[model samples]
Target: MKKRLRDLGEDALIARLLRGFPGGENLRVGPGDDCAVVDPGRGLLRLLKTDAIVEGVHFLPDTPAAKVGWKAVARVLSDFAAMGGVPEHLLVTVAVDPAKPVAWMDGLYRGIRKCLATHGGVLAGGETSRLPSGAMISVAGEGRVERKHLILRSGGKPGDLVVVTGRLGGSIRGKHLTFTPRLNEAAWLVRNLRPSAMMDLSDGLAKDLPRLAEASGCGFEFGEVPATRGCTRAQALGDGEDYELLFTVSPRRWIAAAGQWPKDFPQLSIIGRLCPPGQGASLAGGWDHFSP
Candidate 1:
């Protein structure tokens, strides 16, 4: 009997699909982290990712096109932020009905432009196509990280402090469309105190936390979770698309990093601590695409 995709779950499905591909010599990172990394021998590693948003799937049709476009660019930029990298160039490929209103397309590009300009990147160029149903916008983002400064989700170890940038939960209530990526903070953290591991919290903590733990060969334990206003503790744990930064550091380094946390940057909090596998860890209730 043929097995349905639901049987494997997202993470397993991804791993199964990626198992046979051969990683090239210069490929420093592959399909696992926020971005794929390539070494060009320039003392820097290039960050690459392609992300797309479907109209009805990612946003309501009634939502503003500008916000839709902004989300498209921001999503990719957030991945760069996760890896302690800086975006340099963006390529936008959009699919829309040929008859789509002119104003709608204009607004979308306007939003995309603002994000690129704000984040020190340029919209070099891209291709456009006509699609049958809802519009689709894809962004190919390129960034760079100092070879030594690049952070991965697999470097965490036992006894590290699990920290988060900004509050969690309630992203579906407009936060997902507007929350800024913590690029500045990620850069500062990686430069000053090397984190054991890090990643942007696009999925809820409940789901993403296990990902970090599994990648790092560790587990985690936590007390109070920082829930956002109008959000329940469960939502804080399960609601996806927070886009905040989740990272780990040695407890000793965290003390120094905390003391020097930038006053102007987003608030940082120690939400948990890492431990040996099967220790105090919670991995329940998160978005699963194939859940029935």
Candidate 2:
């Protein structure tokens, strides 16, 4: 019989599953990373990403309709932020059970509208379908970055400084519900310093950083990670949903911008450096879809 994930727990299960997967040419980073990376070409790249949130899988049945809607949009926006791209438009598709009330659907749309307005994202177009199961929300976002300025997981070189835009862990408290998108910061980074490599912390850095290293053909060494208030070291390393930017820069540029970066935003920090790839990406913690 196939073993259930809960039998092995989150970390062991992910290790086993990822062990069998192979990397692809277009994929600078694959399933084990913060986010998957694909190279579209050299100049003026388009970033297209989509995420789905299901009623029971992603959120509770009683989750506020508006919050659910916001999350759907925010999740895609977060991916754009990771790439340091400017979000221009989005297409949202929703599926709801026939029994769900019309007002609930209205509330969901209202939440989506609020997020779009906040992020300066234009609602392009999408479709709706009836679901026999429960509600499902999927959002596709379109963003653009100058060819030279686009950041990828493969850009980090050995000895480059690792930096993060915000604190980590315990997002379940309330931060996950109302976290900001980091749109402005991404723009600033792309325009000004231009990180060597960049991605957002959707999955824990322990899992994601290794992916970045693999893409860049390097490894990493962490000195200290900036922890969120009330977060443990393990939590800081493994907890997901921080939605903060993780990037790399030249050591010299990081020193020059260190003073200036804080003036504009309060959450930035340098966490580690890149090294040559050795063993596969090693994380202190891991997440698994099938594991508990």
Highest-lDDT candidate: 1
Query: What value of lDDT does candidate 2 attain over all alpha carbons?
Result: 0.77
Model 2, 42-147: lDDT tens digits are: 5556666778888887677787888888888888888887777777778989998989988888888888899888887899999899998789998887777666
Compared with the true structure, model 1 gives a TM-score of 0.96
**Residue 158 in model 1: lDDT:** 93
Model 1 CA deviation exceeding 4 Å by range: none
Task: For candidate 1, give the lDDT of residue 43.
Answer: 80
Q: Estimated TM-score per prediction?
A: 0.96, 0.84
What are the lDDT scores of the predictions, listed in order? Answer: 0.87, 0.77
Which 10 consecutive residues of model 2 have the lowest summed lDDT? 28-37
Q: In angstroms, how far off is 82's CA in candidate 1?
A: 0.7
- Model 1, position 223, has a per-residue lDDT of 70
